[model samples]
Target: MTMINEPAHTLPVLGEYDVAVAGGGPAGFAAAISAAREGAKTVIIEQTGMIGGIATAGLMSHWAGSAASSVLQELYKRSTVPDIVEKFPWQGTINPEKLKFVMFEMLHEANVHVLLYTFVSGAVKEGTTLKGLIIENKSGRQAVLAKTVIDATGDGDAAARAGAEFVKGREGDGKMQPVTIMFKVAGVDYSRAVFPGGFEANLDVPKGKIQDLSRQALPFPAGHTLLYPSSLPGIVTVNMTNFIGIDGTNADDLAKAEYECRKQMDPIVKFLRDTVPGFEQCFIISTASLLGVRETRHFVGEYTLNEDDILASRVFDDWVVLRAKFNFDIHNIDGPGLDKNGAQKHFPNVDGYSIPYRSLLPKTVDGLILAGRCISGTHKAHSNYRVMPICAAMGEAAGIAASIAAKEKIAPRKVGVKKIQDVLIARGVKP
Candidate 1:
């Protein structure tokens, strides 16, 4: 590594807000809207042109669970495609474009300020409390002051920059789950396609068969491949192709992963066109603008949710959010670990578990809270709660807590759990 010195210059200070959200993804969106609706002067900063992070930009067109929370339920209802609602409780395939529109509308109605095409480059902190954030955009560097900050970046970017203790990847070697680039193909014949259980059925193919097919098609490593029908007819989204041993947080590794994933796309499309029943005429429409990163940075919070908590379906006294009814889905760090078998650890008897408010409060950071997949949790626990629906729920809880903290002029950690719980329950979050 090398370093270069540049002349120091003061950055322009942007307006202050009661609550500042650092990401525009599912968690950020929910946090901003929830805060604003609670009468807090909130601002949501996004690096992209539009909101809806992975769902819109990453091209993940499916919502894995049903209407668990009011905010999620509203998003499902506003989806342009009606069929998504029909699938309820199972899996809902959404129209990404529609989702972007719906999010914008919701934010507008809540009167939340939005800053698009802006990235949080650093944070200004006084000890454990974040006083402001440094942002960079086309307009150059600037700063935004806030009473409380919500880290919904999905990577704990703000928390990490604020000097919060964090961990990345699995326990032993710090190896993370492989990243995938989703692609869409058009000209599929849905009628001829054999989707026994649904579109995700493509992922259920046997591992041996997947390996055999990958070898026959090309030299690319055999991993998991999944295809799901899109909102539009004659089109399908592919969740195949995995780039192993790539560190998502490293710039060099991310660049390499992107290049390698893109190179593997052609062969995958060809494999589908030649062998698949309905994709004979299908061609690559577009690949995701961003790589689908499974795990990156997990912040250390007041309490770390672990594998035992998930398996036992633990309930917290200071419950602040809800997660979808799913399993501990830890993807293999090396190759196609759980992708072949589907990374699901089912809790058949339970609906879902409650995430304690303490998990969102960083252990050492005062005036800051974490949301999305980056919240305090062990690798196994994160696998279950990292999905979009659950992330949104966590964001909603963080927003409510942040707003209350701002109103009372107290640190986020001092906000009462009972206050947050009452508001969440009223907002349609189940206890």
Candidate 2:
């Protein structure tokens, strides 16, 4: 490693806000909108020009979680993100382009400030308290002061930069989930394709030479691919390529993944066209602007979620997210294969499980709230909560908690969990 001295320089304060959110993904969008609606002077910063991180930017247009659950059920009731397209009658697929605008309009209606094309490179901290965020953009380096900060960055960027305790990947080899470059293909024949009832289907024809990625009872099933119907007829979004052995948090590894995953596009299209029934005339259309990096930094919080909690359909008294029905899904950390246990399709309980508020509070940091996949949870649990629908619920809770903390002039961790719970219940969640 090499070290160099950089001269001290003053940074302009961008603006002071009651609540500031980093990463304008699903979690950030919900967090900012909820906070602003609660009368907090909130501002959300996103690294890209567009909001909706994985859903829009990453081109992963599929929505997870059932309509029988909390905020998601309300969204379903209100038709918030319209079922513009459906692979099946109830697959929950969406049009990403439309979703980006929908999220933006919601934030605008809430009067929340949005700063696009900005990166949160660092943070301002006093003792163990996160005071503000250090951001960089075309304008130059600056600061955004805030009373309550929410780390909806998905990668725990703000919390990690503020010296919050965190861990990356799973134990042992410390390998995270594989990254994919989602691409769309056209000229598919609906009648000819296997057309699995759900949005996701693993076509046996596209299976390359299979290996025992997981040598357990599964023996690693064929087809490391997942295809979902696009909003348009004869078009499908393919999440097939898996660039394993790359770290999402490392710049060099991410760069390599972007290059490698893009390279998988043409060959995969050819494979589908050459063998699959519906994709015989299909051709590659577009690759995602961003790689779909599933797992990254998981921040240590007051209580960690685990696989058993999800399996038992557990609920907590201090629960924030209710009836989170997404399965305990995880990709193979060291191989280009799907975790057979991914998306527990046949869970008995329709009531689902709850995500505890304690999991959103970073154990070692004050004035900070966690949301999205990076919240305190095991790798498997993180996979379940990482989906867009569930992430939005967690973000809403974080937003409500943050706004209350800002109004009361208290740290986010010090806010009464019951108050947050009551707000969620009033909003139609039974927590």
Candidate 3:
């Protein structure tokens, strides 16, 4: 890997904006659109060509939550494409390409300036506030001056670099959840795949079966295989197995995991072809360009939502978004064999809870807001809220709040939560 250290220099006032959102994933997309739609000069800087982050790049296969109230709903309303119908209880799938176009059109219609292939390397800080960002691109390093910035990098890169406090992996121990190499398989027989007790049904092959399969040299996870329909018919996305104990931030660790996982996929594919029905010609379409990192640095924000709060369906006066499920299928790749042993420890929850905007505001950082999985929350709570839908919801709130703060020429932390809530409510975003 070629790592270049380009010195940060002031670029000719590359225009100003009310808000500058970094990381054009679900959160950044929502933030940029929300800010621009709310009549703020917004600019989105994405490191990649695409707008949808995990949804497009990671090929996440499906959105793991409902698109009802909260920031999630606001996104659908703000989009330029067709509105999403409430047709889900959980584990909802979306067309990545359609969603991408929708996001692109939304930003365009909102008049938000988008800068793709721009990597935000550092922040240009003034005391506690970041006046702009130092971006590295094909043209070299330059500055993007803005009033407020949102750290939707998912890894909390902005907050961390700005000297914010954060916790990575599990508390105390450095163990983290496994990172899945998500891939899509085409030429699948959807009818046969979704059949009762079919390939998808036998996903959670029992230990007896696992042992039997292991002896028979079949390709499968130790106990279960999670697969879902892709946006295209005759295609299915597979998030099965895991690259255990791989640290996403560590290049070497990720490299090894990728190699091992690719090697391991061969047998699994062979097994599916021979043992499973309607998968004889199934093949790996594409692996995620980047690793699907589940957990990383969780920024310590103004509020730390806990698992109990989610279970109790706790609603806060400062709530910015709502969740529909607790951490149901939580997985950890490291520590005490959690992935192998903790599968049965499901949190009791028939409903989800509200997430406060405070969770997005890092306690130790000023003029910087975080969205996505990096927001403040307990481990268990992160499991539920870390999904894409909630992250996008939080992104909307953060964008609106930042814009409000910018317009008032005040610090983000000084912005009133009530004002933010008012704007969200007016926009039909359940706050």
Q: Which is superior by TM-score, 2 or 3?
A: 2
Candidate 2 backbone collisions, by pair: none
Instruction: Provide TM-scores for the models.
Output: 0.92, 0.91, 0.86
Superposed Cα deviation of residue 338, candidate 2 (Å): 2.7
Clashing pairs in 3: 178-333, 219-268
For model 3 the TM-score comes to 0.86
lDDT of 2: 0.79
The digit string of per-residue lDDT tens for model 3 on 304-329 reads 98877877989888887765453434
Cα RMSD to the true fold for all candidates = 3.0, 3.8, 4.3
Q: What is the lDDT of residue 12 in candidate 3?
A: 53
> How should the candidates be ordered by TM-score, best one leading?
1, 2, 3
Clashing pairs in 1: 327-345
lDDT of 2 at 160: 92
The models' CA-based lDDT, in order, is 0.79, 0.79, 0.71
